[model samples]
Target: MFSSKSERLFTGMIAAALAVSAVTPVVSVEAKQSEKVTYQAKKQETIEILAPTSPLVFKQGEKLKGKDRILNVKIDGKVKKQPVRWSNLTTSTIGEFTATATYSHKGQTVTLDVPYTVEGYELAIMHTNDTHASLDNAPKRATAVNQLREENANRLLIDAGDVFSGSLYFNKFKGQADLTLMNYMQYDLMVPGNHEFDLGTEAGHPEFAEFIQNAEFPFVSSNVDYSGDQYLNALYSEDLTHKPVDGKLYEGVIKTIDGKKVGFFGLTTEDTANIASPGPIQFQHYIDEAEKAVKSFKQRGVDQIVAVSHLGFDDNPAVDNDLELAKRVEGIDVIIGGHSHSRLNEPVVVADGAEPTVIVQAYQYGDFLGTLDVVFDQNGKIVSHQGKLIDVKTYAADPTAVSLLAPFAQEIESIRNAEIGAEATAAFDNPRDAGDVTKPSVRKNETALGNLITDGMLDRAKQMDGEVVAAIQNAGGIRAPINAGPITTGEVLTTLPFGNTLAVMTLDGSELLSALERSVSVYPIESGGFLHMSGMKVEFDSSKPANSRIVKAQVLKDGQYVDVVPTETYKIATNYFAAKGGDNYLEFKKAYEEGRVNDLGIIDWEIMRDYLVKLQTVTPSVEGRILDVK
Candidate 1:
């Protein structure tokens, strides 16, 4: 599924694994006689090509999706030690071929059999996903893209999206930093990720729709309906699939790759509604729209189809993931996906039917670029495939990329570098307060980082708007840990990279209790909805059942902790995402429905910065704010 630069990865007991694998047949035979089955080793080798010595195999033909024809190398029992060095095991046509690898390490001579069965052939496609406005990584990604372009002149470069709202780069320039670098890479196409609408989705300040208008390439989306908003429609006019809310977004573009037509369309995730404010824009069912797009492309005589998707992928096909899409949608050849940050070393081929759907997704934050080598048979059905997730950090920052980003970098450096506060000798965990300082997890249980974030949110709400009682920050919004030195704005930005705006809402004490119950439902299992609250204390028992986990909760009022009255309404401030029912906060959603929510334009990180600045020196330690009752 994933090919990488030749490096020995200490994954598992490699020698012991091979020994058991060699005995599988005997075990199986004995099992049949005994009427019992033994477990098989799921461990895989970490062997890679040390150099670019391997030559291309198979001829280019009609292209689309199918199972990955993997070339598995078999180790002979006669050979005990094998060298790491291996070279060209090329096949111009379909057949079984043998290659040799010989190497010596630490006085051990090694020999192994490198076997190849040519079942398919190669399309060069380069893609980025969940870039998340990591400015430093963007240039490196650009460098990697350049290298990939040089290697394959006919390669297709694209982004799966979420190229917005993270780090100081986004905090300073919105998303221009990522856009400039992506434009520098000369991406052929891109889709809008959920974070693109984080700035409240109105046709107002921090408008991604307007910013997208300046992009060099087309931004396509077949499912998200922008027809309700005239501004969104105009700003995203180039998004071929925009105006028409039909399952088939009339924007599928067919490109001539080696004189073969390759169709590409975009599909945003359905979860965007729950996670972001898309204003008048609405997302359609991805599976339905994706199928319709594929049918449309097939009707247009497009042999190959690529879906640039932002719908998150999961190991479970039952969820609305790329794997699910691949299982249901047979015609889509390749799906470049984002959202959920699945790092696949090899492409996932779902062989649910006659044709397998190939799914590829790189890890988040532009650290790696996904490169899939898909081989098609004579009829254009995918016969075999190989995938490589290229590490962008390996490449140097291109000068052109550096120059293009200079202005934005300059604008941010002064403010971001300013010293905000200092820790008193102890290094604060990036809020990964999972009881283990080394591991750093805030999603479950209580955390010092969550406490600090809630305190900041509470302070900001009180300062910006009146009648704000308490604040809660979701663990997912905390991005980085602060070191035990002078904490700068840059560190704060990284720590709270989402730049979530504050939203205040009034909910009855019973509703608040319900929200807290939902927050701790997955306690100890690390749910992002885990709430860290200011001006409140939560004492829950995880041993209890969900929705009834909270035993006792108290809200701070007039410098006193009082029992939450079910009939009493309390003003609560939280990040806008959670205010709009993100993290399944149905109570908050209910309040939004009743028009009890007010979203202020104040940025979250700035609020934290102000809080830290007011303190002059901050040493946020875990207090008994949230308790887990045994």
Candidate 2:
């Protein structure tokens, strides 16, 4: 709530106490993150809450562990064998519980709050988000999940969506095989992401509704309302007594977790309209729908609430991220979110005191599994929350997941002409200029993958009907590194997972220059709009003022590099997202609106794959196409 500069600096200190990085973590189960509790009182002993970083899952019909390790008490900078006294232990029901650790020294007593979740049903709530069908990690993820399930008697698995598009797996099976594997994992509930509808309106592709109907788990969406398709209407559920605020579609549902009614609702971002073709499916406001669901849960006397959300956690407040949702509405206890590809090492608490919400998300590609252990007070309000991000690759992949995925792998191998499944001849590296992995080159200046992508687009555009001279791809579109060694279809998809179709747009030299200027406006901060180009050489100073950063620009014309002519028209190739004003490429959007941009309707992956096949062996090097003369 800081307005002035001085106030902002003061409030910044307050934020550190709540959401500080892993070191010297200071938070209690009872008090929310916003409240500043005094710990400087004289004559007090501090106790270290030493609990294991692993998730503490309790399953139904499973024996509870004896003598759980709560915490070690310390008095006046000395470690004691045990805490003076332990309080708050009840085993009658399954719910999140907390205990108090007490120690006495120098006529003063200090108390520490220790929390644990008790259960009569399941031990772990395992979830993954934004996997993007990178099935190569499927075996590794399954390995981690299976080991966790073995130790915990009861387990609940869920997904936060975007299990569509990416690798050859989705390209060949179209989400059917992804669902088959998810079914094998026994996911309890799943929500649809914007990418789930990437093929919804297209012909000859499996629609999202079809995936929903075939899915073993329930697809929940508190804000999405659609009933044109009979199959969708029959399967969709609005079972919660209270409807979402102004929602004409399905709300949330009450699922039995830990032998208790835990109200679980789903919310996808409203931006689905522009991102994907969600035919007949309309979205309701995110915060309003969440508030409505919370009200309904409270009315039904449900204490624990979990929202499986795809509403991303972005810096833009206008986008309605998970943190903003928690702040805007009260009553939600935990929010498992997706769509931003954010990997939160620890769960974040937005405890501005109105029913504090704990938010957690795993990084994309099934590389990590998110685990959040929440303890609810007697009144059902969350008292304590602990979060952990498990590295799936740390353990051996389970054989079951590998077996289940084998058939699809075989199918993809055949369709790839045995090339996509096989390894590539050379390696493509994307590292920082300082020879470090800290900051990737793609987001800042330019990398080999960015060059390769734009080069493919330019090559493909030249093959098509037009005088296409250049290609540009926003940095954000490149998802991951190609790494080294043999490149499989999986690796290629991992690098370009978005499945953005290529568009060859007509842009005059002036507009092109404007586009390049906008691309580097927020230079060092890492913007997705930063353009990677082929057939053009751009030399710019990032320190220069925005919209005027370009020191020089050139395009290949008639087999030679020449200065760009402002009035000269050229057909430039770029992705659909950039062409439609995504990442704030307004010039491209304007061109599309003016009918100057023609969407070639060519898929981007094909261009890259075809380029790779033709080359057979590639040794791409950065030769100053995008120079940062800082």
Top candidate (TM-score) = 2
lDDT of 1 at 401: 87
Q: What's the TM-score of each model vs. the native? A: 0.58, 0.59
Q: How far in Å is the alpha carbon of 90 misplaced in model 2?
A: 9.4
- Candidate 2 Cα errors over 4 Å, as ranges: 1-124, 202-206, 241-250, 418-452, 455-531, 534-537, 540-550, 553-630
lDDT of 1: 0.71
Q: Give the TM-score of candidate 2.
A: 0.59
**Error of model 2, residue 247, in angstroms:** 22
Pairs that collide in candidate 2 are 57-123, 58-122, 58-123, 59-121, 59-154, 60-121, 122-154, 424-487
Worst 10 residues of 2 by lDDT: 10-19
Local accuracy by lDDT, each model: 0.71, 0.71
Q: In angstroms, give how far residue 402 of model 1 lies from its true place.
A: 1.5
lDDT tens digits by residue: candidate 1, 449-513: 77877998898788766688799888878878777778888888788877566778889989999
